[model samples]
Target: MRLFILGLGYSAGHFVRKFGGAFSHVAGTVRDPAKRNDLAGIEVHAFSGSRPGDATLERISEADVLLVSIPPGNGGDPAIAAFADVLAERRRKIIYLSTIGVYGDHGGAWVDESTPPQAAFERTRLRLAAEQAWTNNGSGHVAILRLAGIYGPGRNALVTLRAGTARRIVKPGQVFNRIHADDIASAIMAAILHGRGGTWNVCDDEPAPPQDVIAYAAQLMGVAPPPEEAFETAEMSAMARSFYASSARVSNAKLKCEFGVTLAYPTYREALDALWRAGEGR
Candidate 1:
């Protein structure tokens, strides 16, 4: 199979590293190909979410599978905005990586794909619109993976704590679901192989407090965790504070049942333990 990815960011990059060998041809787009020295041994093209080059468009047309990891912007979905006509001609499998934040603040309650998306937040509202844009315009099989907090490798709590940047912000009764990057890759592969169109919540089995993850990471590293700060009084950016607005324990039962995916790390504990063993913070 031939694979083309749009907005090859963290999770999508991991997916390529883990599963790029599965495809006969693997190519992807980055905002600036010249800056991505790490993306060696693969085709990398430049797409700033506006006008795509002719070569990139040709490859996109030939791809059997396309993975979109870009979020919607002020002009709406970038891929659709740029290549709607080109993409409209072909039939292929599409996997869209979305966030569980679309469920919004659920009062720490469990939510599934059937729950109506809470469009209270503008970010999530755009995400919902982008989801429909892909589904309605792709002219192919589309699987939307509603992901949770994504962390892995150099981006985990272990590294953040060692850098003296880990925060233990305490919000009473707030819990969030997270997914390891490896598991997300697995889900993307599963959805591609399943050859079906649907939406699935891709997250770990555990819904944990943010502070708990940091404390556990510190414990694993045998170091002191950052002091806790109450959410109300904590210093945070508007973007960081916006994340705390949603508190849903997103369910992944459908993903498990349909994709037959068994996450390598079912919770933050296992992920942290494994990362520690691999010398993440050292």
Candidate 2:
């Protein structure tokens, strides 16, 4: 199979790293090709949501599978807008990475694929529109994978605590769903194999308080946990604070049942344990 990725981001890049050998050809787009030398052995092209290079266009034309990891902007999906002709002319398996934030402020309740998207933020509203656009007009089967907070390898709480940047923000009754990058790759593979367009939640089994995660990492490192700051008075960026606006335990039962896959890290504890063993912080 030939694979082409719209945004070779952290999770999508991890997918390629894990499964590139399965494909005969692998190519992807980054905003800047010059800085992506680390993506050796895979064709890297430049595409900042407009005016894709000829090489990128050629790869898209040749791809048998397409993974879109880029979020929609104010103007909507760049891939759909830029490559309408190329995509519409051919059939390819498409995997779109969406976020569980579309469920919007579920008040710490559990949300599943069947729940209607609330989309309290404009960005998530744009995501919802982009998802519909792909399903409505995509040339072939489109798998919409709604993901949770992602962490893995060098990007986990362990590394943050070691770097002295970990924060323990306390919010009453606030819980968040998270997924390891490895499991995200698994979900991508499953979506490719399933081949029947559908939406599924991609997350671990836990819906945990944010502070507990930092404290656990500190414990693993034999260091004191960062002091906790109440959400109401915590100093955080707008985007960071915005995340606390919604709390939902997203269910991935559909992913497990339909894809017939087992998560390597089923919860944050298992994931942290595995990361610690892998020397992520030490």
Candidate 3:
């Protein structure tokens, strides 16, 4: 199998790391020249502009699977648009990494694949549109992975806690869902190996209040937990505040039932605890 990834962000990085040599050929794109050397052994190409390089195009055409991790933005994805014609012709399987934010504020309700996306935020609305663009381009081989807030290793919110920057903002009964990077990678692998297409949520089974998570991380670090702030009065940037606006208990039942996969870290406590121990070199 051949795999070509259009984006090299954190999720894509984990995907390639977990499935690099499984394919006969694996090629990826990065925006930075300095980072081009980061994807050693695997073919890496620069893609700052809309145009796809010759090597990148060839890799896409020959790829059995094309994974796109570029998040939705104002201008949308030019690389995907640039290769839409060839992609339509190749009939290659495509996986687009999306976010559960597309579901909008569900009032902490559990949502599954059957639920229609009612994106209430601009970013998620853009994502919904991007999802449509890909589906409208061609066949049904495209699979969309709607991931939860991804945390693992150095990227965990625990780092923010340890830095004494963690905030405990209680928004009544607001809840959040998160998934580990390893679990996200495993879900992608399951989707690929099983050849399943359609939307699937890749999240952990646990959903907890934001304050509880902050307190838990602080407790594990043996530090006094930060005091709570009024959710409405909490001082946060527009983007950060926007993120806290939505609350939902994202379901992973579809992932387990359909993909026959179980999370490596089923709960935030387990995941954060593991990361804490690992950081302490225990």
Candidate 4:
């Protein structure tokens, strides 16, 4: 099997590390030609332009599986906008990495794949629109994984705590779901192997408060938890504060039942503990 990735960012990179061995050929696009060295064996193509060049399209056409992890810009999905026609004709299995934010402020209510999107922000609206575009333009089976806040290795709360940027901002009754990077890769691999088509929520078993996660990370690191600041009085950027607006407990029932996935890090505590032991925060 040949696998091609549109954006080899963090999550997609993890996917490659976990599953690239299964494919006979692997290639991906990166915005910077200078970072080609970082991609190791995979063929790296320049994708910094408005549309993929002829060489990139040739790579896209040669793949048996494709994963898109790029966010939509104002002009919309770069891949879909550029090669929707070509993609519609390919027999490739496609997966689009999307966010759980599309479900919008559920008032801490539980949500699943069946719930209709009620996007609360322009970013999420764009994601929803991009998802629809892929669904409409593509003849191949597309599995959309609506992921939660992703954390692993250098990107978790332990790193934030060590950096002295960990903040315990208390928002009463507000909770958010999260998934470890390895789990995200695992879920994607499951989707690829099963050839499932449709939307699925990819997250851990627990939905927790932001403050609680930070506190737990602190405990694991043997450090004092950051001082609490009520959300109303906290000094934060608009983007950071906007995350609190969508308080939903995302369910992973579909991921487990439909895809038969067993998450490597089923909860934030498990992931944080493992990262801490591995000295990821240090």
Candidate 5:
């Protein structure tokens, strides 16, 4: 099956690296022509100006399955809306990557697909609306995967800590669920191959304290862990601090039971250790 991906950022990069050539054909869209080189060998199209070009619509028509890892637009994707009718007519399978942040500030409780999204923050509320809009409006089945925090090789807590800036921020027991980028790719592939129309939480089994993760990464780097910043005292941007304020652990049971998939790195400790061993400290 041909898989067309919109957006070539972190998650999209993982998807492309893992499944680019495996499919009958692969195509990707980049908002900037400068990034067209990044999607080399696969079919690349530049979406310039304020809107999508005709070529993008044509690519959507050709795809059997479409994966959208782009950030939720202010009012859902205009690009997707541009071809929604054609996409529905083609009956394409869609995988829209969302975030567990939609279930905002659960106070460290476990959440499942049935959990109503609290969305304490505007960004998450927007994402929730985007997910619903695509699923309800499209004729094709939309598999919404509410992903947890994503980390990998150069883009993880290990690297952040090793950059001589690991802060043991204590929120007095706030917890987080994270998934390895490779595992995120695996989960998406599993959904494409085995899942039906539904929503699932994609996260590693272990939920951990942020401070503990920071300490472990510092130990691996052989450096004194960065200063402890109390969550209230840490100088944070409005957006950054707001995200940290959302404190909860997500449940991955639905992902495992529904997709029959297993995470290669089931815990942050294991995943971070592996990353450090790979010389991620650069």
Candidate 6:
């Protein structure tokens, strides 16, 4: 099997690292050609503008599976806009990475794949649109993975604490779901093996407070926890504060039941503890 990735970013990079060997040929697109050094074994091509070049189009035609990790811009999904015709004709399996933010605020309630998306933010609205675009373009060959906040090695609260930029922001009754990068890779692999096409929520079992995660990381690192700041009183950027608007516990029952996925790190505590033991937060 051959795989083509539109964006070889952090989470997608982990997927490639874990599953690239399974595919006989693996290729990906990067915004900068210089990042090819970072992609290692995969064949890399430049794709910054809306449309991909002839070389990329050729690769797309030859691919059996396509993973789109690229975010949509104001103009909509770049990949869809550029390659809708090509994708419509290929009949290849597609997996679009989306966010749980598309569910909007549920007042700390549980939201599953069955819940209709009520996107409040422009970013999330674009994600919902992108999911629809890929589903429409791929016909019945698309699987949309609505992921929670992604955290893993080199990109976790541990890294933030070590950098001295960690903040223990407290918002009462607020909780968020998170998924480890490795689990995301496993989910993608499972989806490929199962060959099921639909929407699925990919996240951990726990819905935790933002401050608790930081505190856990600090304890694991044997450092004093950052000062607590109330969300309402804290000085934060519009983008950062916007995150506090949504408070929902995303469910992964569908991922486990449908895709038969068993997460490597089912909660932040397990992930942070493992990262700490590996000398990550030194």
TM of each candidate vs. truth: 0.98, 0.98, 0.94, 0.97, 0.94, 0.98
Candidate 2, residues 113-200: lDDT per residue as tens digits?
A: 9999997889989999999988977799999999999999999999999888999999999999999999999999999989599899
CA lDDT, candidate 4, residue 254:
89
Q: Which residue segments of model 3 deviate by more than 4 Å?
A: 138-140, 280-282
Computed on alpha carbons, the lDDT of every model, listed in order, comes to 0.92, 0.92, 0.82, 0.89, 0.80, 0.89
Which 10-residue span in candidate 4 carries the lowest summed lDDT?
Answer: 45-54
lDDT ranking from best to worst?
A: 1, 2, 6, 4, 3, 5
Tens digits of per-residue lDDT for model 5, 113-203:
8888886777877888888877876567789998998889678877786566557778876988888999999888887886467899999
Tens-digit lDDT string for candidate 4 (151-236): 88789999999999889999999999999999999999988887658999999999999899999988888899999999999999
Model 2 stretches with alpha carbons more than 4 Å out: none
- Single out the weakest 10-residue window by summed lDDT for candidate 1: 33-42
Cα lDDT tens digits, model 6, 38-116, are 7888899888755678999988888899999999999899888887777866677788899888999999999898888
C-alpha lDDT (0 to 100) for residue 177 of candidate 1: 93
**RMSD after Cα superposition, model 4:** 1.1
Residues 162-193 of candidate 1: C-alpha lDDT, one tens digit per residue: 99989999999999899999999999999999
lDDT of 4 at 176: 90
The residue ranges of model 5 lying beyond 4 angstroms of the native Cα positions read none
The all-Cα superposition gives candidate 2 an RMSD in Å to the true structure of 0.9
Better of 1 and 4 by TM-score: 1
The segments of candidate 4 whose C-alpha lies over 4 angstroms from its true place after superposition are none
Better of 1 and 6 by TM-score: 1
Residue 117, candidate 6: Cα error in Å is 1.0
